[model samples]
Every structure is written in structure tokens, then in C-alpha cells.
Target: MRLRHKPWADQYMKDNNHILIQEPFEQKGCWKQLFDQQERPLHLEVGTGKGQFIAGMGEQHSEVNFVGIERVKSVIVGALKKVKAKETTNTRLAYVDAEDLRDLFVENEIDHIYLNFSDPWPKNRHEKRRLTYPTFLEQYQHILKDEGEITLKTDNLTFFEYSLVSFSKFGMTLQEVNLDLHETGDETNVPTEYEEKFSQKGQPIYRCRASFSK
Candidate 1:
């Protein structure tokens, strides 16, 4: 997705330093201490596009701590605004690359990982760039607790299939698979901005839950 240049985005991020983590590497393994409930389960959202999903999840599950990491400054500012508006104390936003997961978190630090509408990187040559690639899976397994799981939701069918295969190859067990999420009328399912837009256009939404422990 092409993002419009926001001249003030950098400054805006600095302005919200309290909730927006500017230097995530420094807080590695201490994320729980950043929130009011230090013992709450910590959930990390890989690519929080626009922030609607993470903020909504925070409001829905107060017992869980949410940290949304988005690399794009312009795109992340939008998410920061949503989180700020919601004032969800258990949630925080971070501006960092997914590659730095190891630098920003320790083993068994995360309870769950969320991948909402992540870029498919469709080309065969770009497979390594996909979030479900082995490199990322290894990092996820190292950081997630024994029972930690990954919850993925996307509108792309090919990407969904590819992710399932990737997870299976990595020895991750698929706990749940939903081909048509909306059709199931699962009220507990929170919709991201992209999910709402695509579903409104009559597109099917695919979701899967895969545990790190095989």
C-alpha cells in the first residue's frame, strides 16, 4: 500500500512518546512493566495498519496487553491517533521493523502474535519477505511461550493458502481455520479496517490460529 507523505508525522510520534515507543530495543523483556497490569498477557501485532484492530482488541480484552508495531511512520501515526483517542491503558504502539523482534523482546515474552492483513509479498522470489517465512517463524517460536499462538486474518486466498503451508512446514499446529469468517456470524471476531472494507465488497475473509508448540 502506498502511503501519503506526512510532513509532521515524525514530530507527532515524538509528541506521543508516552504511548508511542520510539526506542523499542531498550525495553526488551520489560514490556509488561510498561503497562498498568504487569501480569497481564502480552499480545503483539506485527503490522498494525491504521491501528483500528489493535485499539478495538484492547477495548474488548482489558486483561490483555497490546503492543502494535508498524514500520511506516506515516501509517503508524494514524494508528497512534486511534490508540490515543481510545485511551486504552493496556495498549501501546511501537515504530520499528519486524526484523528487530529479537532485539525488542526476549524468549517467552509474548503470549500471542497477531498478523492482521499483512502484505502477502506475492512473488515467489519475495517469499522470504513474507511474515510466515521460516526466518520469522523461528523468531516467533523463540519469543512466544510454549502455548503461544499466532492468529492471522487476511482477505487474499493465495496468501492464506501459502501461510497454512508455511505454518505446517514449520511444525506449527493449526488449531482453527475459518474460510468465511463473516458467514459464521462470529460476533467475537473483531474486524480491522481492511477486513471491514473487503467484507463489505462481498469478499471472503480467511482466518487461522496456529500454535507455536507442535
Candidate 2:
């Protein structure tokens, strides 16, 4: 769902350039320098909506660094605000498209990726636009380390099933598949804004962890 353009979003992005990286391409392989702990593992959240998950993860795991990628300025501004509120040195936001991920990171630069409630792109003609599409997967494979894993969560069963098939066809091994994530009462699960809302209404959340290493 496209967010309504916020008139102040652009200014907010500029004002918080430190937390919201303006020229992410320039950072490339040196993303770790942005954090205090440069040696810590780096994780990327492909579609960090409203920044709830990333903020929670940063607070929970101070030892790891997190970078959130969101193309929409209006959407990312919310994430920037949350991260800024936390005053965390390990979390950063980038206003860039997912398609340009290769331009922002070098090979084997990323340790893990999180895809939370990405657009289903359910129409047959839009299959190629899905995040789990082969082309996107290839981009992910290039930046991710050999043992890196992609963890995904979605409320849409169709998209989840499609992602499972896509991963399998790409020779990626599924390490874990949870048909109903919330049922397990996993305290480690960081709920995004959408996840919390869906779970509140009795919606089943599907989650899976897949890696390129077979």
C-alpha cells in the first residue's frame, strides 16, 4: 500500500541525514562505519514500514547493526523518526529502492535480510515485481554472505506460498517454515506494525527462513 505523500517528509529526511543516509550508494561496502561497533554483523530490512521492527530489533540486539531500505520518502520518514527516538548508533535508514540494492552494497557485504509484509503483487502479470522473484533473489544473493539467510513474514498465504516455490526453484534451502508464527509465542519475534495489527484480528502470520546455501 502506497502511503499518502507527506508534505514534510522530504525536509524531515534532509534534517535527519545522519540517521537517514541520503547518499547510500556512497557508503557501499563501508556501511559498518556508520555504527559504533564496526565489527558487528549487518542486517538489512528490505521494506521497513514505519520502522517498528528495526527499532525493536536494534534495542533487543545491541551487538548487531541494522540498515533499513525504503524507497518511499514518506514511508521511510516514519522509520527515521523511530530510530532517532531510540538514539541508537547501530540502526540506520536509507531512502532507496530495493532494485538498487547492488549499488549500495558490495558482494558478501550483508549478513542477513528481513522481508516483512512485502507487497504481494498478486496479479499474474506482476510476478516479476515480487521481492522473491528470481531477479531480486539474484541481487540478494550477490550482496549476501555465503551463509546469509533471508527471513520473510507475510499475512498473505498466496504470496508466502509463491515465495516458498520461488526459493525452492532457485535452489535455496528452507531452514524453517512457520505456517502460523504467532502461535508459537516466540518472544524473539519482533512484530512490525502490520504484524501486530493482523495478529490482533486473528490473522495467521506465515514466516520462513531460507538461505542460498543448500
Candidate 3:
């Protein structure tokens, strides 16, 4: 669902040049250097809505560089506000299109990718649009390390099953498969807006981490 645009979003994106990256393609293959050349592991969150999960992770893991990518300018503005209000140093927000993701980073430049509550693209015809689809996975592979991890969390059953099969078909080894992440009390989670709301209504949350060997 597309979010309603906030009036101040455009202005906020302009004024917050420190946190919002406008031309991410220019930093392809050199994102680490842009983050002060620290060489810390780069972790990316796709579709970072409201920025709660990445912002929290940024605070908890200061050693890791966190980049949250949201295509919608208005949507990413919320995350920008979260990063600013939290006074976090390790996290940055980027306005990026998922289809062009491969162009924004060179091969083996990303260490991890997080997909939280991503749009299911439920219809059979729209399967190609799913984040875990073979096409998207192929794109991610261009940027991720050999053993780089992709963590996913969602409350949708069909999407969960589809993702599990997709990962297996892509030659990825799945780990920490939890059909009920919230009930299982897996403490290492940073909840997204959708996860928190869905879990509160006795809904089951699914989570897993997949890694590619090749």
C-alpha cells in the first residue's frame, strides 16, 4: 500500500543531507568509504518503513554500518526523523529503487540484507515482484558476500511458505526457521511496525535466516 505523502517530506529530504543519500548510485562499490572508511560490515534493510527496526539495530550494534533503503521519499522521511531523533551515528537512510539495487552497489559489497514485512505480491502473476523471487535474489547475490545472510520476518503464511521454497531452490541454506517468532521469544529481533501490530493480535510471526554457499 502506498503511504499518503506528508507535506514536509520534500523539504525534510532537502535539509537533512547528512542522513538522506540522494544519489546512491554514485557511491556504488564505495559505500564503506563514505561511512568514514571504517571497513565495518555493511548491513542493509530494504523497504525500511518508519525506520524503527534499523534505527534500533544501529543503536544496539555500533560497530556495524546500517543503511536503510526506502524507495518512497515520503516514507523514508519517517526513518530519517527516527535516525535524527535517536541521534544515531551508524545508520543512514537512502532513497533507492529495488529494481536498480544492483547498480547501487558492486559485487560483494554488502555483508547482509534484511527484509522485514515486505509486500507479499501475493498473486501468481506478480510472483516475480516478490523480494524473495529468483530475480531479486539474483540481484542481491551480485552485492552480497558468499556467506552473506538474508533475514526475513513476516506474518503472511503463503508468503512464508513461498519464501522457504524459493530459498531452497536458489541453493541457500536456511537457519533459525521460526513459525512463531514472537511466541518463541527469540530475543534478538528488532520489530518492524507491521510485526508489532500483527503480533499483538495473536498473529503468528515467521522468521528465518538464509545464507548462500557459492
Candidate 4:
């Protein structure tokens, strides 16, 4: 995904305390304590495009501490803006590369992981870069607790199919799978920025919830 550099994004993140976690490794296993909630199950969105999904989650489930980390600082800034406007107390954002994820989270630290509209990395040679690849799934394993769950939403059929194969290849058991999510009429579904835009254009949304057992 192409992203424009926001001249003030860095400054905005720096100025807002508790919104963007700086040097997240320092808080590794105890990240939830950073929010006012001392003890709560933690949920994370690996590539929160614009924070719509995560922000809604934070607002809806105040008991769960929600964390969103994005590789692109400029794009993450937009998520931060939405989160800030809502004053959602149980959420935090951080700019971190997905490849270095293990460095910032200790074993069994996360309860659930959410992936929404992540980059597909279409080229076959670049399969390693896809978020649903085995390498990334291994990273998720290190940070998730026992029987941890992962929820994914995407509009790309190829990537969705690839992810399903990757998940099963890595011993993940899929609990729910929906090829056309909008048709399900699930009221609990929270649409991301891209999900909303794409669905409006008559694109089908694919979603699944899978669990990884230790």
C-alpha cells in the first residue's frame, strides 16, 4: 500500500501521551497496565489501517484492552486521530514493524489478534512478506496465550484463500468462516475503512476466526 508521509504525524504521536506506545519492548508482558485498566484480556490489531475497527472495538468492549500497531507511521497516525477523538480509555497505538513483533511482546502475552485488510503482497516471490504466512503465524504464536484466537477480515479472495491454507498448515483450527460476511447480517461486525468502502462497491467480504492451541 502506498502511503504519503505526514509531516506532523511524528509530532502528533509524540505529543499525545498514552496514545502511541514509545519503545513498546520496555512494557513487553505487561502492556495492558499502560491503560488505566490494571488487569484485562488484551486484543491487538496487527495492521489497523485507519483505526475504525479497533476504535469501535475499544469503545464497544471497554473491559478488553485493545492495542493497534502499524508498520507505516503515517497511516497509523490516522488511526491515532480517530482513537483520540473518541477518548477511548482502553486503547493504545504503536508504530512497530510486524517482523520485529516478537521483540516487543513476550510469550503468551496476548489474548486475541485481529487482522483487517492487511497487505496481500501479491507477487509469488514476495509470499514471505504476506501477514498470514507461516513466519508471521509463528510470531503470533509467541505472543498469544494458550488457545489464543485470531480474527481476520479481508476483501481479497486470493489472500483469504492463502491465509486459510496457511492457518491450517500451521495447526490452527478455524472456528468460523464466512465468504460473504455482509450477507450474514451479523450485527456485531465492525467494518474497517476499507471494508466499508469496498462493500459499498459490491465487493464481498471474507472473514474467519481461528484458534491456535499450544
TM-score winner: 1
Residue 185 in candidate 2, Cα distance off native in Å: 0.7
Q: Measured by TM-score, how close is model 1 to the native structure?
A: 0.96
Against the hidden reference, what TM-scores do the models get?
A: 0.96, 0.96, 0.96, 0.95
Q: Report the lDDT of model 1 for residue 14.
A: 95
Q: CA shift at 1, candidate 4, in angstroms?
A: 6.7
Q: lDDT values of the candidates?
A: 0.92, 0.93, 0.88, 0.89
Span of ten consecutive residues with least summed lDDT in model 2: 1-10
Across 158-213, the per-residue lDDT of candidate 4 in tens digits comes to 99999999999999999999999999999989899999999999999999999985
> Where is model 1 more than 4 Å wrong at Cα?
none
What is candidate 1's lDDT per residue for 1-214, written digit by digit as tens?
Answer: 5779999988999999988988888899899989989989999999998999998999999999999999888889999999999878989999887565888899999999999998999999999998999999999998999999999999999999999999998888999999999999998888999999999999999999999754
Which pairs of residues clash in candidate 3, taking residues 3 or more apart in a chain or in different chains?
A: none
User: Where does model 4 exceed 4 Å of error?
Assistant: none
In model 2, what is the error at residue 128, expressed in angstroms? 0.1
RMSD of each: 1.1, 1.3, 1.3, 1.4
> Which clashing pairs does model 4 show?
none
Superposed Cα deviation of residue 140, candidate 1 (Å): 0.5
Model 2 score (lDDT): 0.93
Write down the TM-score for model 4. Answer: 0.95
Candidate 2 lDDT over 38-94, as tens digits, reads: 999999999898999999999899999999998877888989989999888889999
